[model samples]
Target: MSLVARIATLAQRDAITTTGIVLSGVWLFLVALFWLLAPGGEGTQGGIARLVVMVGTILPLVLIWLAVRTARAIAVLRAEAADLRQRLAQLRDTAAPRGAPRMAEPEPLAEPDRQPRAPAPVPVAPRPLSRPLAESRSPAAPAEGRALDPVDADTLILALNFPDGPDDSLAVSALRRALQDGDHARVLRAAQDVVTLLAGQDLYMDDLPPDPAPPAVWRRFAEGARGSAVAPLGGIHDAAALDIASSLLERDEIFRDTAHHFLRHFDAMLMRHLPDMDDAQIAVLAETRSARAFMLLGRIAGVFG
Candidate 1:
C-alpha cells in the first residue's frame, strides 16, 4: 500500500500514541488561540506576572511537544498500517474466498479452528502431557504423535480470553517452559491462571485483569492432547468450548491429572473408529463427554477395571 494508505490505517487503529496525538492537537490549538486573544500584563509584575509568564512559556512548550508527538505517532502508525496491508494482501492471495464477510459469518478474528469452509483443521488425537505414557507407544497410534505444545493449549483455552484482548504470547511461553521441564503440575497451574479471566462476568477486554485469560495456542488442550472423544460434550460450535471450559473451572485443580490421562486413552479410540462413524455416531461420542468429565472428577466409577 502507499504511504497515505498506511498512515490512514494506523490512524484507524487503536493505540495509545494515537490518543496522545489527538490530545496534543487540541491543547496546541486552544493555547494558540489564548495567546492571540489575551491582553499583555500591565505592570502587574509579581506572582500574578509569573503565572502569566508561565502560561506564555507553556505555549511554546506545548507546540514543541505536539511536534514531537505528531512525528512519533505518524512514524508508528505508518509502520503498523504497512504491516496490516501486507497481511491483507497475503490473505487475498492464499485461501479462496469462502463467502462474503457477513454480520454472522465466521470472523477473521475468530480462532483458526473456528473456520469451517477454509480447510479441515486437524481432528484431535490422544497423547500424554509430560511424556508419552506406555500405551501410546503401541502400533495403534498414528506413527507420528502430536507434541503437547503451548499453542495448542492456548487454543483449547480460547473460551478464557476476554474480547479484543492481548495475544496470549506470555502464557504460551510459560506453558511451553513448564512442559519442557516435564513439570506437568506447573502446566496445570498455568491453566488455572486463566480461570478468573474466562469465568469473569465482564466480557470486554478493557475490564480484563491486565493479563489475557490464557494462551490461544492450546486453550482447547483436552481435545488437542487427547482428541475429540474427551471434547466438551458440546460440539465445537458456537460457545461450546467456552461453556465446557467454564464447567470444568471449579474442578480443574482436583481433576487436572485424571482429565489429562483419561482424555489420552479416549482420544486414541475415537481416532481409530472415526472413519466408520457418521453424525449419529458422532453425537453419541459427544454425549458421552459429560460422563467422561465425571470420570475425571472421580464422581463416577472407573470402567477400565
Candidate 2:
C-alpha cells in the first residue's frame, strides 16, 4: 500500500480506538458516581445487584467497541481495495505487450505510399520528417522532395489518434506528414499535450466511452453553435472522469492551461476542416483518440454548454 493510504488507515484506527476508549471511560465514570451517590442495600443482595450493574455497563461497552472495531476494519479493507485498483490501472498503462519491440528509440518515418506493417504496440515520439516543409516548391507541395500528397482528412484523423505502438506504421506515417504542416502540427501538438496531462491523472481517452451524438450535432458544434445546442457534443459523462477533470481544472494551473489550449486548437480545427468533411467523415473523426480528448477537455473547459 502507498504511504498515504497507510497513514490514513492508521489515523482511522487511532480515531476509532480513541472514541471507543472515551465512551467506555465515560460510562464507567458515570456508573461509579451513581454507585457512590446511591449505595445499594447491604450484604449478599447488594453484592448481587452491584455485580449485575457492572456486567450491564461493561457488556454495552464491549459491544460498542466490537462494532466500532468492525467498522474500522471494513473501512481499512475498502481503502486497501481502492489502492489496489489504482495500482492495477497504472500497471496496465505502463506494461508493454509481450514480444512487442520497445519504442523508446526514434525511427525514420515510413513513406506515405508504402504499405503499413503490423500495428505497433506502443506510442512513438514525434520526429522530424526527412524533408522539411520549406523544401516543397509550393504551399500545396508535399513535405518530401517527391510529389507528396496533401494531408487528407483520413491522414489527419490518424495523426490525431496517434500511433498506438511502434508497429502502427500507418498512424506514424500520417503523423509525420501532419507534423510537416503548420496548422495541423499546432492542433496535433495541443492534443498531445492535453492527452499526456490527462494520462498523468490516470484519465485515458480510450477508457472514456462518450455518448454518441449524431453528425448534425457535431456539425452544429463545428459551426458557431454553443450552450444547449452544442451540449450534446460534450458527450463524455463518466462521473469519475468528470469529477477528476473538474477538480484538476479548478486546482491545477498546468492542467487547466493545457485543457484550454487543447480546446482552442480543437475548436479552430473543427471550424476550419468540418466544412470539407461529410457526416461519415465527421463521425469517424469524432471516434479518434484526439477527438475524444477534445470532447473530454472541451466539456471540462466549458467550450460546450
What candidate 1 gets wrong by more than 4 Å, as runs, is 1-44, 67-71, 95-305
- The CA lDDT of each predicted structure is 0.35, 0.69
| Error in Å for residue 85 of model 2 | 29
Tell me, by lDDT, which candidate is best: 2
Per-residue accuracy of model 2 over 69-100 as CA lDDT, tens digit each: 89799879977977866664454344323111
The regions of model 2 sitting more than 4 angstroms off are 1-149
Clashing pairs in 2: 120-165, 120-167, 120-168, 122-165
- Name the weakest run of 10 consecutive residues (lDDT summed) in model 1: 130-139
lDDT of 1 at 166: 24
Q: After superposition, how far is residue 255 of candidate 2 from its true place, in Å?
A: 1.1
